[model samples]
Target: MLKDIVDVLADPVDGTPLRCADDLSRLVSESGHSYDVARQGYVTLAGGRGLNHEGDSAEMVTARELFLSQGHFAPFVEAVTERVAEVIDKSHAPEPVVLEVGAGTGYYLSHTLDSIDGSRGVGMDISVPAAKLLAKAHPRVGAVVADAWEGLPLLDASVDALTVIFAPRNPAEFARVLRDDAEAVILLADQGHLDELREPLGILGVKSGKLERMMRQAEGYLELVGDAELLEFPIRLDRASIAAQVGMSPSARHVEAGVLRERLARLPEFMDVTARAQLVRMRKS
Candidate 1:
């Protein structure tokens, strides 16, 4: 899998091109930097100082995998995959490179890669646990652990398409890596998302004006390519899925497990919760 997208990877220290070593167990950059491929098949492309922060914990990643595998968010995944297909179809690159920032567990990235013929993916996340899962998520995906805030450790103008779903995004870095025809597809949770679980589970709600703030932030690096699409769907979730949803989110870090369990126990057997998000497609200006 790493071999598939090795051409698009770069050394975090100096941005040199990377290639598989003699034995394929390690990657050596043009600058002579070597990063060992983990037994699970992913590589950590952080700077020499190493990762400053862990994005998601093992429990969180596990929760995410469990929750996502249940297909409650199938519509969201379908929308992302469909858009990625459109982007790839529009691009003339024979073998396009798809990059996903803060790609958790590689769920969406792997799905997109499967839909696009001759397409490879780079799944970038700061969490090692997430990277481990990402490495094996698809046959054509290469997983790397790197901070999205610092900058994407990718070659300039090397990416054909980028996707960000419920994760951190750096527009400047995106602009640097995406080709002229490439677009960055972002999915942001909107206000009233998961409203039914907010009061009952004591979880935080999506903030207002998030999309407007994001557009303002992307002003210099990226411009709107099309009208943002509002994706709304209803998920009938059980208590376990509700727990997994909470466990995989930021609220999981603040709430005590026992308290969260007690709150989830009081909920009904099934809930029709609203999952709402906006898909904004942007391109380098």
Candidate 2:
């Protein structure tokens, strides 16, 4: 379905419209820039110098797929999907486009699409492994490989609803891509998220004032639309689930594989852990 979002796509190097060419095997831009569509069904739209950082590794992406599939983050996903549905309904834009930044595995994006009728998703991520999963995550999703921190590979004011869950954000780029009436739904881990597993597993803990800092960062580019919503829930996680949670997070990079395995084995057979996060909606200023 790369053709589904062709109109919204712009040349990463020059922000020009792109068209499916060579019988849809390539994307040719008006400025003479061309990008090839991978046989796996995704495309990389980085600029001349390429991406500055790799978003997630194959192992991290795989772990994320496994963890998310178990539905531990169901509340978080539901909140995001409901917010997206509300946005799409209020916009009255018949053919809506939803963009998910750092859309790893496309779990949240695919869910949002299912909730909103006739909506398409742009699953943008920098990792090839993530893109591979994103390509097939849903029938209506168009996966693109690009850095989230840099400028997004999209046309100005082309997106209807944007979602970012524990992902990087570029306020200026977000403002540029979102329409004036469009909204951005953001979910950030709050203080005490996964606190139960931190000490026992020696994993990283959530920092305080994350939402406050994020609002401060979005000063000029975006403004808060409604009151921030807080969601906190407890999940019973087995040892395998615990490992998957840690493996898909920044803590994975901090701990050595063997040492981390040993630490996981020391935990109980099953433990109750809190999954806490805050959801906020913003509009382009």
Which one is best on lDDT?
2
Model 1: colliding residue pairs: none
TM-score of 2: 0.99
Q: What is the C-alpha RMSD of each candidate to the true structure, in Å?
A: 1.0, 0.8
Tens digit per residue, CA lDDT, model 2, 198-221: 988788899999988988989999
Off by over 4 Å in 2: none
TM-scores across all candidates? 0.98, 0.99
**How high is the CA lDDT of each candidate model?**
0.91, 0.93
Error in Å for residue 178 of model 1:
0.2
Q: After superposition, how far is residue 252 of candidate 1 from its true place, in Å?
A: 1.2
